[model samples]
Target: MGTKPPSPWDRHPSRSRPERAHRERPTDSNASMHADHKRELRLYGLNAVRAVFARRPEAIRKVYLNEARIPQLQALLKWCAVHRIGYRVVEDADLQKLAASSHHEGVVADVLREPAQSLLTWLQALSSDRHCALWLDGVGNPHNLGAILRSAAHFGVAAILLPQHSSLALSGAAARVAEGGAEAVPFVQLGESVEAIAQLHAAGFALAATVVAGGEDVFAAELPRRLVYVLGAEGEGMDRGLAADCDLRLSIVGSGAVESLNVASATAVLLAEWSRRGA
Candidate 1:
């Protein structure tokens, strides 16, 4: 008999299936890179996604989803339909890679906001509002900043200001922690928080800072007509210049066993007390 023709699968002795690209391989790396370069972040988490929809629906360039996340995706789609926002479906792995972490929970949002602007202009615009501001002197960590932001929004602060070079803008990690507050609150970037405090002083706002030593007790200090509380970095506290600019250096009184409080914790205490003063 003539040699049997080889089956397609068995045709090549050493041939094997080509490795498939992972489902999460980013097809839009260039696009994502552009977003990163522009200081925009790819965000996930249900609340974070909801916040973006509620606050800046137009800011979202796209929304990606996986089959597993369809329930949440449906809700988002409903909202997007109402708002006229566009979105797409993708594999779960793609979202994980886009988020750059596994915490994405199968949903990712491409955010676009006006490039960060000076806190001064925002402060100037809010010049007439009867509200307070929080100046993060040098809080370097995004978690601390995001936590503080959540507290700020809940307590009704007008805005939160950070130093220009302090760290990245509201990141995905921050958005996750803030639980939607990140979008609700306006984050302003300033040249130097110390210099910003000076302008705040000139603008007739009371500037209070947290210090471990030689500062008035937070409970005892008389908050001003308009208040701006300055909380230092978690480890370094406030810079000397920033500390000096404060109208009053206030300290949260706690058990002496602990050397100091986390900057975010200190801020929550001060904001709570300040809010209580209003009530």
Candidate 2:
């Protein structure tokens, strides 16, 4: 039997980082944040910035890199030129203040925001046969969000759904922890869980709520083709009403010592299992 040849990405594991492509600076501009670009957030670190450059160069509104990192960020600067995006070099100290931390790896960006679609519009848009997305009920820690997104992208989950009122938002810390997953995966804001779950049911997704008990072992059962894995914060777990709305409840089996897994950790496990089941 002949199988299709895999794409370069299929062969290249998602964990590997691409080395920076070098180039020279062209006409430059200041690194000031504009009111029009208020929607844009600053992203830092080499991998995170590189991911933005690779995935969507147009999103980058401005570039600020340390003078010493000029060579390392040449590709980004050249991109700024070709894209007519503005950029400027700053001392490493300026970078610290701009990034509000010393972990920026001498690079930051005012990445533009894409207009968000309504939840109905988003659900209408996903007409694919197999649909898998992560829904957060109350999870808001940026680092955990990033970790979940990293795993979600790695295993080919379609999107990350956050409630509109959730405290989660795109920040440099989250983007940096995602290590480019932020650029790779789609993020959507959902409204009330009841309303959203009803729409999901109409869309034909198997709503599986991850819980401490009253759920099946994902490793043992066959997952549906179209599934929505609803997970929540470590302590609170999913909202009771939301959990009741799910078609199935799923749990990860462990050694029975710890009461539960962190939301991000459990998400990675479930996503891995979802892929393993060939869903």
Where does candidate 1 stray beyond 4 Å?
1-39, 78-94, 127-129, 192-195
Query: What's the lDDT for all of these models?
Result: 0.73, 0.78
lDDT of 2 at 76: 74
The residue-by-residue lDDT of candidate 2 on 54-76, one tens digit each, is 87887887777766777676777
Q: Could you tell me the lDDT of residue 17 within candidate 2? A: 31
Clashes of each: 1, 0
Q: Score candidate 1 by TM-score against the native.
A: 0.78
Whose TM-score is greatest here?
A: 2
